[model samples]
Target: MIRIVLIGLWICAVALGTLFFTVKSHMPASGDAGEKASYLGGIDYATTDVFSVPIMTDGSVAGYIIAQLIYTVDIKMKARITVPLEYFVKDEIFRQFYGSYSDTKQVEKVDFERVRKSAIDGINRHFPEPVVRDLLVEQFTFMPSSEIREMNMKSIGKRLSEH
Candidate 1:
């Protein structure tokens, strides 16, 4: 009876060890997990803060364009950029919108494809290599100056009434 009990305990230990080893072998290594963390292994996204630009028409302020953008760059290439990408993005957006005013004055018909291509090209031109992969519009909107003034007035009125 004592020998049988000892043999049964040994068999249980062996089975547990085999199960542990099997699970361990099937599990991903630490290095593999790290690689998976960066699913886009080579590409990374850089997002810009919300910014606004005044659209000029006939040498005066027409309205304002508010925008926020996200751009993609190769993770390796991003390290090579010395200046913040926001500068390029904002400049491109301004140039595109402001420049269009001279041609048509109406931004409603703006071609998004052209803007995307232009932004990518414009940013790439400043770099030694084309580091900017693509541009994505997170927010692109136009608010007339009158609408802004009206909104501000309403806000002020509400605040005064609360007091």
Candidate 2:
């Protein structure tokens, strides 16, 4: 039993060492590549800053969704642009978001997955060829209207000053 345990431990150590050696500096920042790929498989990936998506009600802004997005594709993805492809993707992101008319229509509830799919579809339509394999919403925040922020700030400020 002791000898078997020792051999098992040795095998684990060797496996771990090999994994670290192979992945070091090669693993991209995020996501699961599984046995098929690394993060984007070391392919070109684009990310966006937090998008303040306005939620409209009664023809006015009701709330906002702070969304950060990621676009991942295979290493073969290419583009013809003077600016970094990320920036170009960023511009297209907003265009696709607003083009859905979500800001104009009163969206009482937000389905993030639905929004993500719509955005992807819109972007693909804008592009003659599909460029992104997947659209990942890394961060999604639902912020209340500006009126709420001011009221909250004032309440906090009043309490802070009292103390």
Candidate 3:
């Protein structure tokens, strides 16, 4: 048993070392390639919790849009801002979805590029210098109210069967 355990540990160490070296070899060198690398050290990302917006049509809740956003900011400049960055991102996402619903009368189609542009522009408007570098949409999903009701009904049925 002891010998087997020692062999397993050695194998794990070798695997880890191989993985590390492989990743290191593929990493961009600090030269011309470094210039093209988007994630240099000076930038930091702020991720927002999931935001949900109820789409309204004809004075009733038509569906729901769920989104998660990430915003990149300059690390040095982030400290100067008083309010948290996530708040602005969440507000912008909500506005984008809400505004789109109003303009198109449905949330089936989304212009992701427009959302990103508006988010960066909207947040930057408050500050003299542009603080938000870019906006990233990690998750964006839509579910109709009827599907939600169906899901709820199924869940209720399952719970009742369990009891």
Tell me the TM-score of each prediction against the true structure.
0.72, 0.54, 0.71
lDDT per prediction? 0.83, 0.65, 0.82
Q: Which residue pairs clash in candidate 2?
A: none
Best by lDDT: 1
- Where model 3 places Cα greater than 4 Å from the true spot, the runs are 1-39, 102-105
Q: How do the residues 20-72 of candidate 2 rate in per-residue lDDT, one tens digit apiece?
A: 98988686545555645644354677677666756556577677657787887
TM match of model 2 to true structure: 0.54
Off by over 4 Å in 2: 1-42, 83-108, 146-148, 155-163
| Pairwise TM-score winner, candidates 1 and 2 | 1
lDDT of 1 by residue, 4-65 (tens): 99999999999999999999997767775878756467888888999988877778777788
Model 1's alpha-carbon lDDT is: 0.83
lDDT string, candidate 3, 18-71, tens digits: 999999998988887776675566688888898898887767778888888888
Write down the worst ten-residue block by lDDT for model 2: 99-108
**Full candidate order by TM-score, most accurate first:** 1, 3, 2
Alpha-carbon shift of residue 47 in model 2 (angstroms) = 2.0
The predictions' CA RMSDs to the true structure, in order, are 7.2, 9.4, 6.8
